[model samples]
Target: MSTNKAIFTMKLEPELRDSFMAAAAAADRPASQVVRELMRDYIERQRQADEYREYLSHKVQRARAQRDAGDFATNADVEAQAAARRETLLKQAKEAGV
Candidate 1:
């Protein structure tokens, strides 16, 4: 972890600020630690969401390119193949008593 640190200041309603401090004290954790954890979690979630959006965008572009090139599988065809694979896997698992 980096040793660098910065101070963040914000104004909050007195009631909300007191409630947050009380909750933090009840949990036996410093308010700063809880705020840091919440900030980290929020940042990580946003990062993951952005990554997933990029992944989907790429997939859509690829699918469009394939369609334009007349080299694409129909939804029904893909579903049928997936179902067949699932059946084969199930059969193998049954044979293995899995």
Candidate 2:
């Protein structure tokens, strides 16, 4: 055990606390260790979520910049391009007897 640890407290339902303790006991591990692992995992997931949000915000900004500069395609243009590609593929598939 580390001497630098601090005690933290919070409130939760009695059933949840009992279930968690039971699970830890079943696994032959300390409940405190299980709580520490859960807290660390939760923090890591939150950090990843924050990073993804930052990336998505940057992507949206870039897209807006492109749209503002008139350097982007319209939805109709994209749909027409997709339809043309699909038609080409279908023709090629027929030619190949596929």
Candidate 3:
């Protein structure tokens, strides 16, 4: 991919701003490079998230079709199950230091 240079302004708490500058200095890279690297990583994560959403959408559609064909949980039951799954994931993340 072709990289284009751009300038942007940001506001940060003083402590965080100072820390970022210090880290950039220690790493021997410009603050711009650090910000750009972070942005690139964030963009990649966003792209993956969008792809995940698309996959989940398709899975949900298929599940709905199955329900129409006579296989499915009640809405309340499904929601409870999803809530439990979310909690499990959250707990796992916490345990993993995320």
Q: List the residue pairs that clash in candidate 2.
A: none
Which window of ten consecutive residues has the lowest lDDT sum in model 3? Answer: 1-10
Predicted candidate 3 versus true structure: per-residue lDDT over 1-98, tens digit per residue: 66876779988999999999999999999999889899999999999999999999999999989989988778999999999999999999999999
**Candidates 1 and 3: which is better by lDDT?**
1
- Candidate 1 local lDDT, residue 41: 100
Please provide, for model 1 over 1-98, each residue's C-alpha lDDT reduced to its tens digit, 9 standing for 90 to 100. 99999999999999999999999999999999999999999999999999999999999999999999999888999999999999999999999999
C-alpha RMSD by candidate, in order: 5.4, 2.7, 13.2
Q: Pick the candidate with the highest TM-score.
A: 2
Residues forming the 10-long window of minimal summed lDDT in candidate 1: 65-74
**Candidate closest to the true structure, highest lDDT:** 1
Q: How many collisions between residues are there in candidate 1?
A: 0
Which tens-of-lDDT digit does each residue in 1-56 have in candidate 2? 77798899989899999998999999999999989999999999999999999999
Q: Which is the winner by TM-score between candidate 1 and candidate 3?
A: 1
TM-score, cand. 3 = 0.65
lDDT of 3 at 24: 97
As for TM-score, the candidate ahead, 1 or 2, is 2
